[model samples]
Target: MSKSVPSFLQNELSGSVMTMYSGDYGGVEVQGNIQFSINYVQKLREFHIFVAQCRDLAAVDPKRGRSDPYVKSYLVPDKAKIGKRKTSVKKKTLNPIFNELLRYRLRMEHLRTQTLILSVWHHDTFGRNSFLGEVDVDLSKWDFDHTQMNYLALKSRPTSSLQPSDDRGEMKLAIRFLPQVSHSPGKDPPSNKGEVHIWVKDCKNLPLIRGATINPYVKCFVLPDMSRKSRQKTRVLRSTVEPVFNHTMVYDGFRQEDLKEACVELTVWDRDKLASNLLGGLRLGPGTGRSYGALVNWMDSNADEVALWERMMTSPNEWVEDVLPLRMLTTAKTVMK
Candidate 1:
């Protein structure tokens, strides 16, 4: 079955904005022997495969177990409903295709020594096209100024053995990756079979509309956030992210008690302009803007009630025993124990 243009979204592409940028790879051939670059193709393919994985996600029960998992939230048709909100969700078990998406999104959001736009592009000094974005201080490049970085920095491991067995019992190639430490080089060395998997969900039988690609699922795990109160005391904090790949996510890992005890602490910084030398320099986009506003709003809401705030502003305390509320002392002790 050849994939047809989605009838629901066909009108979205009718206007001049849509037409000016040819979405198809072949249609937008330009000078410098550049079509869409390999990086773009890889991202496009991963996104498409994500859609294909949801086909299975839609068929299963999300709450039952980890069977067809994919980070299905973003793919939730903008109109669909989950709970009280119109959010994207699919019913399925642990699907690798979706899991990879979740891992990357979480990793990108958490590791922020600096910020970068993942999907945006830029042109080169030689008049060639390029991806435009910045890397974290951990990652360096000579083209930091001219080249904008895409969100996807790590190259995916490619091979047939990477794909997991699909809904139809067909085994495909797919690869799974762990976040790299700073010392690891750009080129990732391959591992043994089943270490990674890929499931290209494109049916050759279908016509050449955009085909869906599926990713292979490896394991279900949590990314831990480590915080240190002092040089002596360290805390291993765990946050529960609703799995992006699998929307019908319900697990015992995060309990009602955890929810009751969990509260995010915000630190609001006044907006500061970027240095002229830096690319795009300290501009706030939607994420930073919202974060800034949210921090300000929270401070505004609780400015007077929060104790130790004014004192801390004047002096950084070495021994911090005075900040606790009487109500939370018991609860805090129980939690720590």
Candidate 2:
């Protein structure tokens, strides 16, 4: 006898597989299914997901009396191994809460074919890590622009493994481009050459450290020249998520035409005694408004960054402001460029 499927599942899997097995034939019994959905947002330039938390996790370390768990997520069809992210380790716990956000710079047309893979793992100090369970979600089935929180029951890791959360915080930015216009002898211009001014205002909803606020800072880069001289960073704000750095960085010798070939990349990082952890980053260029041409890594095309630069070149006098949400830095292949 065929079991009746739920209306929602029936509608979604209309032409797909829908089956039940009989125990008399030695078929395996289905105990339960995981129930989790991602809260996703499609921005003009990127796809964002907020991985809230996991509940009722299965115990993978019963021998040790408890388990230290963390969540690893990835976006599938990533042959280059670029779309992967991990949450901070939560020690000795069954239910791990990871209020973390993940992002990918994918085209809208290609988004429907993507799949999101989330797995829970048991971390070990001296030995290999253990995989507890996993979940796979189809990006095409998710509703865009709305927040959906789901509780997924742990499931066995699938045989064919592929790959890969949301807004924990937001940052405000102000940008202005000054052109080099000739003026009268008596009246002096602001300077001889042009300049680009960037102001890193403040951030909100930053993740906490040990129940206390985090010391955050902003780093700016004018790519494809990532040299030390081309990079600028703000002073680390002590013990606060919302740090106001009305700080302004002036890039001298900035030409109006440079906007056509150049981009501004801002990344947020948490200050630590040893090594700072990247919080999130934003990239702005002419390509941002029209195409993602300049957004691709320069090494991929074996060409200069100027060849693909495209959007903000037309309006030099107009000041633009962007409210960017910060997401965790994932795989090196994804964020290195």
Candidate 3:
């Protein structure tokens, strides 16, 4: 089946935005293929791939049917900001020649758990970047001596056989904690109580349902209280995987100290008229252990989750934001473990 036209959203405050869904890779001629050569530079203990070119790339600009193409590479699971390397953008071309080298410095042991990812994207000037198709090669299965130019057909992001399914998508979340009752512009007075503002900006590359149609929404719960009063959700945005819900959810009547025992869980769901399915979610708090004098599994978060939570808790009255990747939440129950 051919892919549908991508959704274009523009915030007057922020100008034009570019978004591409996971389903955009349906048509081979449109989503396209990337040419590259991979080799291990043994002398420097570095792995490098030369992004040769991208052919028949998708036209991100629906009106013009044009694409400003670029190639980006990452060592899987470490798709962190610092880990990705990109080629210069070739303006308004479906077939762009980059001929750029992207390298990764690591040891032999690290390669055991790594996968080489080469993704082509359409660069949008004003707002957010859009994803095209990609090709993944598990490093553990590759031969370092094979350095011939590889012509591989690109496809949507593939689930890794090496690791558990964690790449559902990414959510842009901005959190602010008002630790005290204070006067701030465009903010609630809290009536002598502290407040937590959850800014659900948007999501990118959300999981696709059948026919590439999804009515996605964001669901939130402030934990230990999984009651109806504690649950809040955003309006479902139809069709697009990159749904922008620039809405804020506010919770009050808590003391500054209470944040230590609190956990904020944000989940992304595909809202069907009949039933909604949980795509993925994230839990933000200090981490696994006792919360409110009780141990719970839902509060179990690590790395980026704990860091983001601590950043918000420490910076009172300031927005502490981060783009956290959504992970597979195992359980359906909202109760404590």
Candidate 4:
């Protein structure tokens, strides 16, 4: 179930995944129109993109009669996984109704520097995905307050080295930074110590151990400090796939700058008596590949995780919550980097 991509698309996507925004409207036929709406809510400081549908799309596979089209999007100049958003594939159809919402959390000033590019593709199970068409929207031209579908003409939009979607279940939680200042008249003047609240509500669609139920528990570590002192765990809920452990792990003595430098790694595991089985986990941080002042490998948070963290960091005392997809872990290596 594979198809060769168009030569032009292959050429454009060769050396890079998507280095667009260079006015490279490479010669591509106008084959479709995408319907989507844009809205910006000031309270949450997030931009919500409602991708409605696509009509009269081109059939790349004429013998197959239609295409397996899906939408891929991201903000320009920052293709870091945190900025990318995608929709599920619609099989063998010329018009796909995708009532999906893609969100990005950022302040107004940061949004101005970015361009939103939404591209359509034909998904191939074993081969490279074929490019269909795309629409690049200027973040400033549309009215942010009102919600109305924009029928943008899809055109030749170069390339995107894409990755297939994964279903490793999702974790829901709330994060908040409550800045603290203590005054005892003498001692140590004043410190910018703050408390980070991570409320692990529960997990949905957890996997089983071996055709049997799993006793799942969650573990947390505020990173750069994966020490024993920083290791915190929640009680295991037995014989359940979807476990609800209304637990909160609080890490204190962190300054305002420390929040910017630190990453939160939360993992799900099956407590087999004294031993453990790794189900999956997620990292919440800036996803910069480097943290503090050094180069490290643990800053692997995706766009959704980064957005949730950014929302919590910017909102200060407010509780920012989101459901983030967990990454599946296969092996329990000697150490986690």
Candidate number achieving the greatest TM-score relative to the actual structure: 3
Lowest-lDDT window of 10 residues in candidate 2?
13-22
- Give the distance in Å from residue 96's predicted Cα in candidate 3 to where it truly belongs: 9.7
Model 1: lDDT of residue 315: 34
In terms of lDDT, which candidate is strongest? 4
Instruction: Name the regions of candidate 2 deviating beyond 4 angstroms.
Output: 1-109, 114-168, 181-193, 209-211, 287-312, 330-337
- Model 1 reaches what TM-score against the true structure? 0.14
Candidate 1 stretches with Cα past 4 Å from truth are 1-215, 223-247, 253-337
C-alpha RMSD of candidate 4: 13.8
User: For model 2, how does the per-residue alpha-carbon lDDT over 55-77 read when each residue is reduced to its tens digit?
Assistant: 66555556654567766666666
Per-candidate TM-scores read 0.14, 0.46, 0.58, 0.55
Clashing pairs in 3: none
lDDT of 3 by residue, 32-68 (tens): 7888998888788777888888887877876787888
The stretch of ten residues in a row with the least summed lDDT in candidate 3 is 8-17
Better of 2 and 4 by lDDT: 4
- lDDT of each prediction vs. the true structure? 0.18, 0.56, 0.70, 0.71
RMSD to native, candidate 2: 16.7
lDDT of 1 by residue, 199-257 (tens): 11111111111223222221111101112320111111111111022111111222222
Q: Residue 166's C-alpha lDDT in candidate 4?
A: 35
Q: All candidates: CA RMSD in angstroms? A: 26.9, 16.7, 12.2, 13.8
- Write model 4 residue lDDT over 147-227, tens digit each, in one string: 988998888754554332333446889999888745575776565687888999998656554556779999998776656
